[model samples]
Target: MEDSGMRIGEVAERTGLSVRTLRHYDEVGVVSPSGYTPGGFRLYSGDDIERIMLIRRMKPLEFTLEEMRGFLDAVDHPDTPGARKTIALIRAEAATRLEKLRRRVGYAEEFLRLVEDL
Candidate 1:
């Protein structure tokens, strides 16, 4: 797991994700902490934080939890044939989404400029 000793609160603060959101991600099995204190506090690793960040990035892409899980699994097992296929599809979809977001942002900037001129 290469787990870090960082607690859940630290992880939430560092990742800009709420504590409840981190807990929910744990509950949903999207990203579970790699360790726990004897007092029952959740502890996260660096890898766990990276995984959470990946999930956060995917949120703007409107990926469902299942899709996030699949993507994570694919990342974890890139050598698998199915994982490779999933990665290919997700990569293409992400590029398309990025292009769309760029276009939308351009429109938004244009609107803001017009509004500012008034």
Candidate 2:
């Protein structure tokens, strides 16, 4: 397996992702493994690990799977002008998500205050 690639379980452990979640990502064409072993186990390379990390970062920003794929595609073709546009879009979306999270935190604090008053 050393010459081939890391197994899915190993990748999950290293990436802190559940096996089911990794499988789902593969199923959804979000982060397919680099290859498969003779026994049909998925093999992930360092590049795949980096890609999964990117997806993980994007998840908190609420990027859909399709959007994640688009981002990954842009990353793969960094020379394209569209890559710059995609990154700008992702940054804008992240700002929006951050604002929503701030609002939710404020609402949670208000709820806590109401409970304390009671």
Candidate 3:
């Protein structure tokens, strides 16, 4: 079934994805609209909405644009196994980032304590 062909604003609101992000996605060949309005506004279908949501969730996990491109490209395969590999990679990367953040937080706390001693 075809969707109502949502405008860019609607897509941004619905997916919690900024319009700029959507445009960037389009520019990077990540998630593109199925059609366009007369004014060249991107029009998104239901599938595009799902893809946008997936990209939104993945971004916060600290997935770089290059990593995202690789994962998105893997989806074009005839099989669905790439999802598992993608998830595994995200988990590992997120864990590493979390540890780095924890170290930064500890350093910040120490700095605060030292400042209070003055």
Please report the candidate that would top lDDT against the real structure: 1
Q: Looking at model 3, which ten-residue stretch has the lowest summed lDDT? A: 72-81
Candidate 1 structure lDDT: 0.91
**lDDT of every model, 2 decimals:** 0.91, 0.89, 0.81
Clashes of each: 1, 0, 0
In TM-score terms, which candidate is top? 1
Alpha-carbon runs more than 4 Å astray in model 2: 1-3, 109-118
Per-residue CA lDDT of model 3 for 1-118, tens digit only, reads 2334999999999988789989999998888999987777788998889888887877656678878776776665626767768756766887887788778889999999999998
User: Across residues 11-37, which tens digit of lDDT does each residue of candidate 1 receive?
Assistant: 989989999999999999999999887
Mind sharing the TM-score for model 1? 0.92
- In angstroms, the error of model 3 at 80 is 10
